[model samples]
Target: MTYRVFSRATVLGTAALLMLGHLPQAHADNAEDLITRGRYIADASDCSACHTVKGGRPFAGGMAFKLPTGSIYSSNITPDPAHGIGGWSEAEFSRAVREGTRQNGASLYPAMPFPSYARMSDSDIHALYAYFMKGVQPVAEAPPASDIPWPLSMRWPMSLWRAAFAPSVPSAQKDVTRPFPDPAIARGAYLVEGPGHCGACHSPRGVALQEKALSGSGGPLFLSGGAPIDGFVPTSLRQDQRTGLASWSEDDIVAFLSTGRNRKGEAFGGMTDAISHGTQHLSQEDLHAMARYLLSLDPGHPTATAWHYDPAAAAALQRGDTTAQGAKLYVDHCAACHRTDGRGYAPAFPPLAGNPVVMSDKPDSLVHVVQSGAALPGMAKAPSAFVMPAYGRMLSTQQIADVVTFIRGAWGNNASPVDAATVAGLEKSAPRPVLQDKPAPLN
Candidate 1:
């Protein structure tokens, strides 16, 4: 064999050519990976909860949000060039997501929760863009224009609101992947503060309708509980024993997020949508991390005592005592499902005793659930869809009020009693449920 003396330059040149030959495949693989990551981010963000309606094409966007001023519909986020975001460049998409700016430099309404999304890392945003632009199927349908009246309907004020209330736009190249000392906590924080946007519904809003706190840095007000939205009030996510998750273990939190129910309670209202479209699909690791971070939070009200189960109400009911204001009504209607002890069948009918949502100082959710009832969304782990029948048609307003008051005060529950006036107000404002030809399956 003849030994060939090759120059180092020649060897390096050949190596470069070989590397270049594989570059296309590498690029393609990277793009696919980014798109995959983006899909996960979208799910974590619960984008579909706002963008898609029941039985509608995913991300086609026709869901209407009824605001105090008027109703505003979500815009199509699919890749259709004409009616969706297909025409948007990555920069345009970034601006819209991070800065609340639209394709035409107009500002997006806060209904999009850009204030929370503004904290998302650039890498995450890039991945989200990749998925929306490449992975998602395009839809040509455009949602109807917002019914918000003029002045409020105008987009200009949105820019001002964003500037004043929203977090500053994150640096384009910055990756805020680790803001906490613990890796798991950091991951959870990112998910909650950025894409998860839990504060949008859970945190109270100021006079300007901006969330009081964006993160834990905003103090106890963060995730402390919010005003009613669509009849149901978002319960506190903090550590308060009475009205928050102080009773929930990390495992319980994980179970609730993944399956929409746990030993403590079952999801209803917007939370059902969140579980069905968003959290149920998340990896166990992510769910655990979220649970861990949530558990780490300090109680919103440090002085609040842990809830203890008292059987006084149960004892009274067992003795056939109908003297209590709403005792007869509860025994007549709710006892079969929720039981006399106020402890319902586990993972089926949620236990009312020591339940955080029930004990919440704000009785909006309790009243709403009593009036409108709620449907549990089915998921992979839990497929049986359970619905609490609406009593609006069956029970008079006073009867409903009395029953709610009894539940709230029963079983050692520390919640304030709701009166007929409060119940009447919620009933009047509550959305009229669409009458179905066939009754929903209770199981």
Candidate 2:
């Protein structure tokens, strides 16, 4: 038989037809891929942080959110037909995730972070649904009902809030796309804005109490930071040299995520939970991607005076001076772990000199740590776990303020001085758990 010659267009057309003929199989393969991706997305989102109770089955729910008005327990999300979302269709799940509406037409509190989830792509949502439905084990346990009081408990107002604050999701058929200069940056943006929901804590809030910026580009406030969570202020993720991550390299961010501690300091408070559950499990590539994206953000605001080593404070500290209450306090209480030089034992007590945590403008994280103390989240990669002893009972408000001021100002940290009134207000807002006579052993 004589071979028939074909034009390039004709050959391409035939190849397209062949691909279309295998569309069903391709679609099935895509579904599997989506399920796999969904698992990663779920981990990145730290769904377990809110949905799963401590020592409980994953995604079975029961975690209680202690809000301003009252406590709200997370709903069971396992694929149990009776107690979970097993019966939910993809549409229903998407609505709940993106619109903050329950299958029963009830409004979900902003605590769910659906406003950020609204930015999620349809493919990602589909993937998440597939993962939840097919991959997760089913549990029949029902979540406890919310304990929010009268008017606040009502769901109707949330609809109004949703309408006012929530970003609109494109139709499922329409693809939502964000253009980034690099593919890695785009991936990082997705993780931060969609699933990670970093802005829910890092971004400032508007008058209506909604997050001021949903995504990094929404404004300077996006990750410029000033938001408060559980009495701790989430520090700025911006590139500001003094208050933000300007000094951190991409590796520093990756190290912190992987081990919950970097050269700068260890994560505490809400960040501990995020690292222990969410980011620690992420692939090195993903962590790097997130770091790359974060590094690209503009600095929130440049400080008038850059931080430099304080010779005067060093001299005073060296002189055995008990004149400044702060210096005396540091010597008596902090010197053992933090050391007289402020260079704490790495991978343990974290350094104070040039540390971002110490230099942050808000001082909330520092105050919270001093007042409540914190148990470092256990991570597989970390060498050991430690607990900071709570000083709320031992230290007077002025003493706490004084010590905080000393650290912030003494070690090349140029943040504003903290006052006793500020310390007292935080103490009242969020009281620490009672400390036992004997300290718990660091594992």
Top lDDT prediction, candidate number: 1
Residue 78 of model 2 has an lDDT of 90
Clashing pairs in 2: none
lDDT tens per residue, model 1, 299-372: 88999998899999999889888799899999988999899999999798899999988888878788787778
Q: For each candidate, C-alpha RMSD in Å?
A: 2.8, 5.7
**Going through the candidates in order, what is the number of backbone clashes in each?**
0, 0
How many clashing pairs does model 1 include? 0
- Runs in model 2 with CA error above 4 Å? 1-35, 171-176, 303-305, 434-443
What's the TM-score of every candidate structure? 0.93, 0.87
Q: What overall lDDT, based on C-alpha atoms, would model 2 receive against the true structure?
A: 0.83
- CA lDDT of 324 in candidate 2? 62
* Cα TM-score of candidate 2: 0.87
Pairs clashing within candidate 1? none
